[model samples]
Target: MEHNLLQAFTTRKHTVLTSSKIDPTGATSTGSLKVKDNISTQGSQEKLGKSGEEEKNLKSNKKLEMRAKDTGSFNIKMNPLNKDSLDKPDENGREEKSTESSKKMQTKKSETGEGHDNSSFEAHQETQGAKGHHGNQTTTAKIQQTTAFISKQDNKRQANQTQIGRSGSNVMLDVRRRDCSKTKCQYVIWQCHHQCMGWGDRLRGIISVYAFAILTGREYRISHTFPCNLKEFFHGNKTLWDEKVITAEHATKRNIKLFGFLPTFGSWVLQSSNLSETFPEDIITFRTNNDIIPYLRFNKNFTKTIEKAFSMPIDDFHYVTLFRRLFHELFSPNKQFEEKFQKYYQLLKPSNDSTLVCAQIRLQFIKVSGMKNVFKFLQETIKRVGKSKLLVSTDAENVRSAAKTLFPEQLVDIEGPLGHVDKPGSGCRDMEKALTDFLMLSKCDILIHSPSGFGQQAAMLKYPYKDVYQINYAGVITNLTIPIFKLENLYEELGPLGGEQPPSLPSRYIKNPQKYFT
Candidate 1:
């Protein structure tokens, strides 16, 4: 019996989980079942022994007649197949002893349900409870026990251990990382819808953008960086330039003077300064027009600048040159000019300087040697009403020659020393020179003028005119009221008297028969 029991202990087909392999403190191992801590396993066995005794007594006390008693404890019985048990027969004398033993075996197998020793299960539970109560094991030992328990139920397992000591405690990290939202940065261009008089309108938009850039220190690359649609800038048809369109920065940077276009330059750049402070009136453009003059009047800056530029009596030629230089500075869009105006315009105020300019238009009479010009009539009209206002028109050369001839005593024949006299529609530099020459004279409240475009410019000055006059050969003096006039009638009447009448030379004049009849 001892040998059989020893053999059963060794070859019971059980699994062993030794503490030496699991927990360093050592644990109990009977079959595959591992029970940690020897004390708990011993206690569990003691409890099981008590339960067995109690179960035996309960079975003995049961009444044996008709019904089977249901005792929770599993029933045990001896094997009936053994020769020792077969030797006994029941009182019925028919092998009842063997039959009873077989019945007990069947009952034990059925009652136990699981074909395992219950004592081992009770021992394992007690061991786990003790380990949980103590809580003194390393994480590795705990993990091993837990894994073993889970492996008993599930076959599949995986491990992913990581050392997380490097990264700071304050930083939170995800095991799996991803990118942020996807969006693109872009820009758009806006445009306008109508027909403006000329490039004046187009340039106005350019100037506006340019001014904004300069004021805010923003950069505007006219061609490559800021390729604008012309239609956006103007009200007419859309245009795609085959070549690069000219830009204000080009002329400003190159320091080039654009003639016939000064009015545009004046309107765009100088106009703003007129409202702010007295800046140099220097301007150059490739074109000029009445539209430019209206712009000056309408713009607060140009009006202010012009008012300040000519506010004081400009007497000396040096002063005039200084004024011209100052004027030019106002018109230049270079960074230097921008900074200067931003500083000066802010300081200038209407109350600080209230000086007004006095304008006069002097139109010379006609000469038979010179041909008729309609520009003179326009000049005479402006002279009539704009004597007090700043006049920008000029006289015809014939009318100017006539003035030199007739008013030789009052006005000197200052011949051809004028620069920029070749500008188209300049009216022979009469307006530019007149503004400089008589800017300080303070004489001639009214312009005593004949018909000429030059006179029209002088009439353009800001003024109230009952003070201007338009003189004709008939000595019929018209008031200085109208801003424009017609000289065609005057020229017809002043022409040679009639047909067949020899042209008589006026006093102090010689017929240029050699230049013509010769």
Candidate 2:
């Protein structure tokens, strides 16, 4: 029986081992004439075993493999978590693996639930090995501590990032962000922080400086009193002031200084018979540079002159309104006006030639009470001077003739139409027109003027000569403290004119002169 069994097995093996022309393993035959008729159809255990061995060999040498792998194919998926895979050499063929890389593999293996029972002994061995390599327990501990510290720091950083992202939520809802309730800083901080730099800050400072400059109303670098005719006030020399910049401070200071001097003018006007108790101080004190008209192209009256003396901006309609209300306070009645006019004459008699001639003509309106004395003074003046050119300004022909008799050869009369205006207080109109022409035309070394606005205005003009003289009216001499006769006496003693005996005058008239009006 054993012989028979051995023979059968050998026959079966032989039959199964038949080789095909195309495939030596006899796996490719398909038709009835193939090995199927020669042996049992089912593949034998020996052939199956041989196929599995071939597949294993194929798995080891991928080049020879034709069939897809079964057991090894599944291992490909698990290879990433395999410790053997991690133990494999790196791209550079280095045998070493970092702890981080090893831990990563272990962690991956843990996720797969495949051999995660890591022993405390293994961990202790790793610690002992690390300590042995470092040769100091503290050093190994410090490395571990540093690693843990870094890990904690990383976690904290992540948490902080989360908090920071949410921090603005409250900020956005803050009431401070509302435009209606915004603080001054909040309104501009964004622009200031991002848009404004050094240049922008400098520009802001410059704008502020300019705004402040405008408020002060001062010349960029110079100063002067208020009611200042910036147009007439020279930048450096008190002329040509229009182009200059000014500030309110400049205007205020100037106004105060100017108004302080107004009382002097006001007091003079107060000393007249027809004058009321009304004082000019009330107006002059309030006047500012803006109210003053610096340049008068046409003739101006007393009211106009006073109006132009202030620096305040004034509209014509407003001026008329103010004038109507303050007329009595500003002007004197004719009788008192004439009296004050006489006082100005005595107070502001010229100290020199042109003024002397002007003053003599001015005395024509005075009473003859001082006439004999004046006549004697004139006779002596002629004898001492011998010969002099006489320019007489007068509306009266009789007065002109009398002056001619006194200086017959030297007399030159300016003849013009006088008092043509029928209106009250308009007598000065014709006189002003005539004087304007005379000033432009006459080349006389000396000049005389009638007791009128035109005469005073003409006298105030800047003339080129050795002497400037004028007869001032009382209403204009506000600061005078001394007697006019005493000043006249002293001036006569000084012999400023061509008089024989010493003329009399006061020190105040010489050193400090009041504004002159004829």
Candidate 3:
């Protein structure tokens, strides 16, 4: 009976050993029987009293332990089988088991779930890790896109801010439409004729009329078609001053021309207490060379109204500031003028380090002695500024030749016949050249010019009004005060009280003076 029992036990052990399979980590393929098979095989070997077989089993167990350590696999110590040794759910709701059964159970779970027996749980874990990495990569790409968009918006905002800051008070000029029709709208048209006036005088009249329109709540337009169309050189920026909008019939019936500095109208038309009442006509046209900005500035009521209209303080409306704002608000260089202007500006090759001194020598107006003094003043200015380029703009060809002869290396001037804008002989190209010269003078750092309205207007348009020295008829260089807009300067030619004469008509006229009126 004992021999029979020993043989049966040996047969059972042999069957268990043949049925079990060991993985590379030494865990059995059948998870449920892994610990059980190891214990049963050891017990059967001891019972048979086979010392060599026992030694062989010990050697194999040692080899598995070494292999587990080398492969960084979890080594299972011999332990009794229990209910907890079976696969149980972990915190993540995934199946987990004891060290001895973990690999085998995970393998079986993967085979059952995915129908891929060759693909182990470790391979699935690697795929999940790769997926997590890709997810992180996707998140990183979105973050970079968001950052780039924000940076682009920031740069755009900065550019807009720079433009606004550079424009100064000009940005505050009312661009909103007045919403009025041709007949119904009260208009202040700057009428230009074939008179003895230049571009500077025309600009002054336009600025004055525009300011008058602003103060009295009227639409401003330009009717300059004598020598050439005003649209040839300049175009309207925010407000279009197209003369075609005004009909010939309307101009004939409703237009009232007011000339400044004359005995009849004098300055009373501009100084009238009630312009709307004084001139009840639909269109009030101005044909004057006198700058009425100072007169407008002297009128406290007018200044207050302008300040209120523009929503700016009275003090902030300096002479230069107001002139610049009016000039830019009314006109922008047309494409043709702009192209020529850019061509000359590029010729200068202006940069932060380069200093350009503009010298305007009007031979038509300035005498020979004055011209000499002007050149002397320019030489002194160039010497003072140090390493300067002299840009010469003049109405006479002789002045250009003289400047080139004087400063061959440092002189810069456009090669063109200088022509007056108001002259009948001047063509479109001449007008374009004149406008280009005016704009280029404004770009210079320092201005040494003769006593000419052209030079004065250019200086007024200059931003940050740098060193400006004007040479009078006697050839004396006077340092003109900047922001040329001052109450005293406005009242200089006019009396201390702001005007020489009062309005000819009363504030309220009982009868319309039809003979004198439009």
* Clash count for each candidate, listed in order shown: 61, 49, 1
Ranking of candidates on TM-score, top first: 3, 2, 1
Write the residue-wise lDDT of candidate 2 on 1-518 in tens digits: 32331122121123321212212222223210111110211111121011222234324434311111221111111122321111222334222333333222211122111221221001000000001111211100000001101001010112121110111111111011122223211010001111111111212222222221222221222222212211221222121112222222212111111110111122122222211121111111111111111111011223343334322222221211221122112112234323433343333222223222332333322222222222222333333343344555544443444555555554444444432222233333343333223332122223333223334333323222212222222101111121122112212221223232211112222221221111
Clashes of 2: 49
Q: What is the TM-score of each candidate against the true structure?
A: 0.21, 0.23, 0.58
Indicate whether candidate 1 or candidate 3 has the larger lDDT.
3
lDDT of 2: 0.23
Poorest 10 consecutive residues by lDDT, candidate 2: 139-148
- What C-alpha lDDT does candidate 3 achieve relative to the native structure? 0.47
Cα shift from native, residue 330, model 3 (Å)? 0.6
Per-candidate Cα lDDT values, in order, are 0.23, 0.23, 0.47
Rank order (by lDDT, best first): 3, 1, 2
Q: Which pairs of residues clash in candidate 3, taking residues 3 or more apart in a chain or in different chains?
A: 319-485
